[model samples]
Target: MIGNGCWFEFDEVRGKIIIDGPMTTDLSFAAEEMQKYVRRAHGMFLPIQRGVLSESTQNAIVVRIMAERLATVEEDGFAITYRNGNVFIEGNGIRSVLYGTYRFLELYAGMRWLTPDHEVIYEPTDRKVWIEERHDRPDFRRRGIILEGVQSASYAIGVIDWMSKNGCDLLMMTIEFWDEHQAALRPEMQARQLRLGLGGHSLDRFLSPGDYFEVHPEWFAWYEGGRVAAQPCFSNQEGIAFLIGRIVDYCRQEPDMDTLSLFPNDNKYFCQCPSCSTQSFVSNYTTFLETVRDQLEADGQSVRIQMLAYNAQIEWTMLESMPEAASLDVMVACWGRDYRQTIGSPAGDRDERFRRIVADWGQACSQRYHSSLSVYEYYADYWMMTSLFPPLARTICKDIEEYRSMGVQEMICLLLPYEKSVRIMQEEIMGLPRENNLADREFNSETPVMWLNLYMFARKLWNSSLDEAGLIDEYCRAAFGQHGDTGKTLLYALEQQLAQLTVYNTRWFKLRYTDVWIRDHRSKGKAVVTGVSPWAKEEDEPEIPAERSEVSRRIVEELEDVWHKAAHQGAHSDESTLLYQALTQYFRYVIQKLRSIDKQSSAQSKLIRQETEEAMSDLTEALQIETEIRGWDALHFAHRLRDPNVL
Candidate 1:
């Protein structure tokens, strides 16, 4: 450690904090964070005070803003230099100032905020520390995360603070207009522009039946027999005018909004009246969109507007030429691509089809109207993390690169909150290992990599060009602390192993119905096995796949090794230990189930029953352990495991 680089004199005791001038909310937040961590580490709470330091001030830590570095550090860039028992944090903007403080906390004060509710500040017993100079800013203009699963107020604040500190500059959370939590979060989201967008699935706000449909039946869509109040008929000139009027009114109320997303409802059916039927759904949508844009421009308003090319809008056949307007960016709503493959790879063929469609629209938008494109991606699956382990982060990283290559910079993600519940079904119990009685235990567990995936998502969005291994290293180091490298290695291996499961439908994947699997990977061999069947009697069950069983056993063994090695790395708590144990046990259950299937022919009825009981037992124990570690409101929506049920 460099002695002169220390910000405060080390006496294994308290320190004084001195401020250089007036404080803004961001700066005040920085001071408070500094105060919280320093005391946490040294048992010495520093009091933040105003004005110049007096001679009586001892071991004083100064928080000062230096304007000289503004030109060098552009936008929200920041720099930190420490010398003569004082730390100086300088920034070009409020975000930079707060970021510098967080960098200081992480590098010098041993602070780590990995997840919303999980924070680690390893206070050194010796209380002797020194941090070298540092500076950084994000690469993307709109580095943000979709706050889909952040359930509570405290959790929301944690996500905001974590993002800001990590150099993220944007957030997409559709908080209700009158939500109480908005007051707490809005202030922190100042430097990072918070965007609220209405989804395409619902247009009640823009074309509400409560106000219009009761009087004008022509305003809504024509259903099987008659008109429905849900979706609007765009052909009616008066209805279109009314819709535009409502939007204008909305803009008047939300004058400070950065962007207004004018999305159609999620349903596939659009207007099919004689006037609307002449053009495709997109033509009708865009005609109104351009009119809205023109109206907004006519009114001299400067709001960036976007809408989704969603549902049937994605199908080239269902729509004509892309929306004719150049001023609006299309937020392409898409899913069903294979996550196991990268965009240019063979596994990505299904993925490439969507890419072509998106690229075509992007080019058209850019060339015709100079408007770029963005995405509303399903980064992960919700609730299914309980069984499936998809390569969520890897796929997200791949998509971001692909999107950037197409000259698309802005990406909005959809989040589905994870719910905790123990599944119960007598027939489903057969899905467990033979001789296992694990289902007797009451517990629910989710994906172990959920937090890691979220962390990588934020970090990569900030710097997509960062080396993959290096990024994983940084995340693991912060998340698992001393055991960080071990965690990183495990995560890297996990991604590879998990990808293998995406295209195969194991009996295990059948526990839940999923259409996520890409292709069948099972070898072309069929032989009867007794213990594993669709509850069939011993005569006709296909032999369990030996290769798959070997793979499962190998994964479990490797995880056990990681679990043990990670013990020495020192986790923030026993949470990591539980995670490892639970993961290891889950694969073991898979292996055990396959074994019983392999031995099905010779096993007695009682023995088969015992085997089924055993697999359930392993599953039960793992979930019981995992329940203690994972949280309820996860924003990494739809982190689904590979499902082989669908073609």
Candidate 2:
């Protein structure tokens, strides 16, 4: 029986899902997903039927590719409406249909995919569904995360599933690893309709030095005084032709590859030959891109070519000089930009340079037929921060708004897995001391803080107008239930503490190692090791300011209090409990790390070593908790603590 003013009644006995269009894989998957979620939420299996429905199918959930109706909708946009005793889900394309189904489940069923391993579903108390018409689309054309470091095939598949559930449409893997795991990864990606992108500093792979250095040395870059096998000689016609041929053959082998990146070797090494030196690296790179685009077109291949605006290629003048090509995608990499602040708010010269580079690229990409501007971000780059959690949700949201305003259509971030830690733990079981293992563990586990940043990044890329605070609260609620407010407080407190600690570290380092020393070493093209004071005598080194040490202590105490309160409230589910344990252990590790830093400045050598040992023990506990929860080891700041004397 239909109630008054009810658009559709979700009757367990009579209601059904009606597919009103040709069934594609994505469409079929969407129907199955809808059915599965409905069953989970209401203990009702809504029978799925493909074809025109009879009049008796009154209270039905209708899904179709209403391309004609969605004339103005983006290719991945969707519309959902409830009218005439039925719920209608419509999209302009197959991917949009799947997105519509997920969105419907989110809005009406209260479902959330918080992390790769965490899902929350809330059942509707009312059987009658009532909703106004709604249409939704992503603000960015390509929203995705790049898999970096080492990971298992199953882990990669889990990330893909999470991306699909969150409406992320792109999945980029480095070419070297993708070749090894594509067999197990491609099917999962195909079923979800996620775009596959392959490449990352992969020019070396296509034209390795070992293969050509002996036969044709001209193929390598001419650096300093002679040729070096760092990168391909972009100006060499023969080398360019060989590189193009290899790329075309690769595309031919993998016809399903949506994008191929020809990013140069991951360094500032560029050809210094007469031909290359006549112009900037960016200009040479642009020529290489144009040349590759021509080759791909001539070969009748449809793979989009990508290049990085990184290192020596980030010059604004060079970017401005290049002519626009519709076939080229430029991914601007933010390697050294400060993550503590938004890109729109430049706090230093480096930040301003990155901002200008992105703006210049945006202007350059605007003339292209396709949205070609992309950003290679590092929100979850564990290696860069030595495995510390980067609390940058608000910064990421504001930065995305800036990018969107600049006509940037795509964004991908580096997200590493915790497999290295798992491998180390297995070795530890064989007889290695945990402290001995800490010295080599560079990549660590993804903490809750990292997951939160990734979650907010994905959400903001889709909807730029979403409030960061609201999203944080939403994630906390989904992850912690009744203790969500406490969880939110703890997260904000941790972020504030980390931000303050960054400031403290900057001040401490500057005081100990004069800025003049850093600038002089940089000018001499020498790598200045951080935390190593240039003073010849140990007594000349500055002491840690008493105020900074006190602030550090206060931060540790505050975090410990909040962590205890949150833990006391407990989690709402089994997964939430595991997350809570990880968070608690990680919090302890952070506190100990701060203590070690504080002690290093003033305490005796023995005291400093003791603090270091305590920090390592706490980190090991956190890693153990992570392995139990995720079936893999997560890395942390153990490497950083290995030499406490340096701090």
Candidate that scores best on lDDT: 2
User: What value of lDDT does candidate 2 attain over all alpha carbons?
Assistant: 0.68
- Mind giving the per-residue lDDT tens digits that candidate 1 earns over 397-451? 7666777777676666544434211222222222332324433332222334555
Candidate 1 contains a number of clashing pairs equal to 27
Error of 2 at 301 (Å): 1.8
- Poorest 10 consecutive residues of model 2 by lDDT? 512-521
Off by over 4 Å in 2: 1-6, 24-26, 122-125, 312-327, 367-371, 420-447, 500-554, 557-577, 601-647
Q: Please report how far candidate 1 places residue 352 from its true position, in Å.
A: 1.5
Assess candidate 1 and give its lDDT.
0.55
TM-score versus the correct structure, for each prediction: 0.69, 0.81
Where model 1 places Cα greater than 4 Å from the true spot, the runs are: 1-26, 51-74, 81-86, 122-135, 149-154, 175-200, 222-226, 290-303, 311-321, 344-348, 361-368, 383-386, 391-393, 420-447, 481-486, 500-647
Ten-residue stretch with the least lDDT total in model 1: 632-641
Error of 2 at 193 (Å): 0.6
